[model samples]
Target: MLLFLMSLNFMVLDNIIMLEYNLLTINSDMIVMTILLDWMSLLFMSFVLFISSMVIFYSEEYMYGDLNINRFVMLVVMFVLSMMLLIISPNLVSILLGWDGLGLVSYCLVIYYQNVKSYNAGMLTALSNRVGDVALLMSIAWMLNYGSWNYIFYLDFMKNDISMMVTSYLVVLAAMTKSAQIPFSSWLPAAMAAPTPVSSLVHSSTLVTAGVYLLIRFNFAFSNNLMMLLLFISSMTMFMSGLGANFEFDLKKIIALSTLSQLGLMMSILALGDYKLAFFHLLIHALFKALLFMCAGNIIHNMGNCQDIRFMGSLVNQMPLTCTYMNICNLSLCGLPFFSGFYSKDLIVEFLSMEYLNMYIYIMFYVSIGLTVCYSFRLVYYTMSGNFNYISLNSLNEENEIMLKGMGGLIFMVIFSGSSLMWIMFPSFYFICLPLYLKLMTLFLIMLGMFIGYEFSKFSLSYSSKSLMTMNLSFFLSSMWNMPFISTFGINYNPLKLGNFYYKNIDQGWSEYMGSQNIYMNLVNSSKFLQILFSNNLKIYLLLMVLWFMFIMFTLF
Candidate 1:
C-alpha cells in the first residue's frame, strides 16, 4: 500500500499537500503543528516504512525465544512512527517531537537486553543524541526571530540574513550528532549492543539518516563557510570510519563503521550543494545496508552467537543461500557495478570530481571511496573464505525459514532499488564531463584498496617480533582513534575530578564550618549562656528586669 501510494505521489510530483493547525496560542504568537508532504517526504516515508516492515518481519525470527519480543517489536514500530513524523514535519516544534522520540526510543531499544554493556551503550547513545536535541531546541528558539517556527516558509528569504546564519549552524550541529559525524561517532558502534534487528532498523534506515535528511531539507540555508566546515568534518569521518573498519575484529562493528563511513559520504555530498544526489544515495544505502545487517544477523544466529570474523570461515560450504545473499550485500557495499549501491555512490563520486574543489578535498573524496572498498573486501575475505575456524561439531545450517523469508523480500530490492529510484527521482541523468584521471579515480582506488585489503588480511603481522613497533599506531586505528574513550571517560574525567575537589573543599570544609552547622552551634552556645545568666544569678536577673522596665518607661515618656 505504501509503495503504491509513493508511486502515485511520484506521478504527480507537482502536487504538495500542507496541513497546519494551531496547537497553542500566546498573545499574538502561536505554536503550530505543520506537515508538508511532497514527493520527497512521500518517497522517503515509503522507503522507511518498507525497510521497517522487512526489519520487523526479520525480527520475528531473529528475536524469537527472547523474553521481551513483543516489547522489542513495539519499540521498533514506535521508531518507525517517529521517523515518519520527522519526515513529514516542516515545523521546528514538530521536528523536535520526532527528534526526541527517535533519541528516547533508540535509547530504550539499545538497553533492551538489560545488561551492563547495553546499559553503557544506551547511556552513550542517549547523551550523545541529547546534544543534538539541545541544538534543535536552540535552532527553534533562534527561528522565532522570523516570527514562525516553520522554517520551510522562510528558508529562502532568511538564507542571506547574517542573523539567521546562527540557526544554520545549530541545525548543522544537530545533524552531525544524529548522523554520528567525527567526535560524536563513538555511540554508533556502541549502539550495536542492541539486538540485530534493532541494529538493522536504527543504523540503516531511521535514526542515523534523520540528520542527513535534515541537511537535505535545509540545504538552502547553509553558508559557504558552513558547507566547507561540513565538508572537512565529513571527509574526516569517512576516512576515520573506513580506516577503523579495516582494523575492527567484531563483525557487527565493522558493518557499523561502514554505515558511519557511508553517512559521511552522504553528508559530504550534501555539503557539496547536491541535495538530490545526497538523498538518492541515502535511499540506496538504506536498502542494501538493512539487507547486510539481516545477513549478519543470520550468520550470528547460526554460529551460536559468535560475531568475531576470525571464528567464521568457509560459509560457502555450509549455508549456501545465506552466503550468496551475504556476498551480494558485501559486493554492493563495495559499490560493485550495476548493484544498488553503485548507482548512487558512483554518481556521487563523479559529481564530486567535477566540482571546483581543492586537491585536498578531491583526494579525500576518492581516497575515502577507495577506503570503503578496502574495508569491504577485507570484511568479505575474513568472513566468507578460508578454513572453518569454529568448532567442528557446530551445526552451522541455514534452516531457519522465517529468517530467510524475511531476507528474501529485500533481495530483489537490494539488486534493483538503485536503478528504480534513479529513474523515478531524477528527471535527467547527471552529465559529468570530467578528465579521464578524475573520472577513473574511484575505480583506481577501488582496485588499490582491494590489493591492500587482501595483503593486509592474508598476512599475519604478529609472526615478526618487529610488529611491536607499530602497536601504538595499530591500536589507534583499531580503537577508532580512541574516540569512545575520549567521548566517555575523557569527557567525564575532568568534571568528576572537579566535583571531588568541590565536594571536599566546599561541601565538607568551608560550607560545614560557615553554614547551618556553625550557625546552629553559635545559637546553642548563646542560648546556654543566657540560661546560665538567668538561672545562676537571681539578683542579676532581677536587676536586668528592672533595667529593661526603666528603658521601656523612658521610651513611652
Candidate 2:
C-alpha cells in the first residue's frame, strides 16, 4: 500500500532517480547494478505490491485450512520480491535474477493444488516461459556489446545499427513468449489450473505482463519493421483468445483467456509506439483482472470446486455481492463505458484507429474487440442467468467475509482507477478526431456482440447443435488454435519416439548381437580352442615320457 502511494508521488514529480553500484571491475569492463526509479518502474512496482498483498489477504479465506499455508505465503512473497527486482533494474544481467525468479515461483504456485492437472499445468507454464528466459539470456549477451549493460541509455541510439538490433529481435522474442503471444499462448489458459489467487496475480501482472512491461521499457529499440511484425502477432493473439473464450465453458479458463486477450491489446498498443498508453492500460487492467480472479475463486469455492459455467446458474439469487462483483469485473473487462477498462481500452482503440494500418490489421483489431464482448456476455448468461443448475444440497452463499473484504478492497479501484490513472499517467490528452461512424463503431460492435452472445447461449432451442456440424473448427478455436497440442504433443512426440527407438534397437537389440553378449561368446570359443590344443599337447608329452622310460630301461639292462 505504501509503495502504491509512493508511485503516485513519483509520477507527479516527473523525475527519474537512478542508483548505480559498481559490483566489480575486471580489466577495463565493469559490472554495475542499476536501479531505475522512474514513474514507470515505481508505478508498476506499486501495482504489483498492491495486488500481491490483496491476494495474500484473500488467501486467508481461500486457502483456509491448508497445511502448507505458510509455504504458500512465502512463495507469494518471493514472487513479489522478484517482480520488484524486475521492475527496478535497468541492467539486463541484474534483471535475470528477477526474470528467472518469476518463472520458478510461478511454477511452484501453479502446481500447488497437488493434482495431476495442476502438475501438468505447472510444467506447461514453466517450460513455455523457459523459451523466453533463454531469449532474455541471449539478449543479455547481445547487450554486452554496448560496453555497459544498462540498456536504458543505449537502446534509442543503437536502434539504427543493424548489428546492434539483434538485441531488439531477441527482446521481442522474449516478450512474445513471456506474454504468451500467438504460438506461445497455450500456456496462459493452462495456467488456470492453478489456485485462483495465483491466477489473479499471475494473470494480472506478475508473470504474463512481465514481457509487455519489458517491451514497454525497451520500446525505443524497436524499428518500424520490428514494430509491424510485433503488431501482427499481437493482433492475432488477441483475436485467437477472444475466439477461444467464447467457445470455452470452464469459468476460470474463460477469465484466463480474457487475460490473454488483454495482454495482446497491451502488446499491440506498445508495438504501435504508445508505451505510456500501454502502461496506463496495464495498470488499470491489473486492478480489474485481479478482482475478477478473486470473484472467480469465490464462486468456485461456493460451487463445491465446480468450475464449469454450465453447472452454475442463478448465482445472483444466493450470492448477490459476488455475482455483482463478477458482473462489474466482466463489464470492466468488456470495456463498458464509465468502467475502469474503458478509460484505457477506449484510448487504445482510438489511438489505433489514428494509425495508418493495413486492412488485415484494422479488421483484426475491431473483430477482436467484438469477440471480447461476445464472450463476456456469454459467460454472464451461463453463470448468472437461467434456472438453478448447481447441486441442491450444496451451500452457496456469501458468508465468507474475508474473501469479500479482500475483493472489496479493489472494487473502488476497479470502478474509478481508469480516470485516476489517466490523469496521472497521461496529463496531456491525445487528439483523436474521427468521423462519427468510426467513433460509433465501438458502441455498435458492443451491441451486436451482446445480441450474438445472447443468441449463442440459447443452445437448447436447437438439439442439433451447431458445434456438431463443424467439430473441427470449434475444437481449433477452443484449443487456442491447437497451440497446446503443438506445445505438448507436436513438440514432444518426435523426441520421445526417437528415444524409444534407440532403447529398443540399440540398447536391447544391438547389445546382444555384437556387444557384451557377442564378446562373451567369442571369449568362450577362444578358450575351448586353447583347451583342445592343451589336451593334445598333454597326450603327446605322456607318450614321449613312456617312450623315454622304455629306452632307459633297455639301456640299463
lDDT of each: 0.89, 0.89
Query: Which residue ranges in model 1 land beyond 4 Å of their true spot?
Result: 1-8, 11-13, 21-31, 463-468, 508-557
State the displacement of the C-alpha of residue 387, model 2, in Å, after optimal TM-score superposition. Answer: 0.9
lDDT tens digits, residues 17-70, model 2? 899888899998777788999878888887888888899999999999899999
| Clash-forming residue pairs, model 2 | none
Q: Which of the numbered candidates is closest to the native, going by highest lDDT? A: 1
lDDT of model 2 at position 207: 90
**lDDT against true structure, model 1:** 0.89
The 10 consecutive residues of candidate 1 with the worst lDDT sum are 460-469
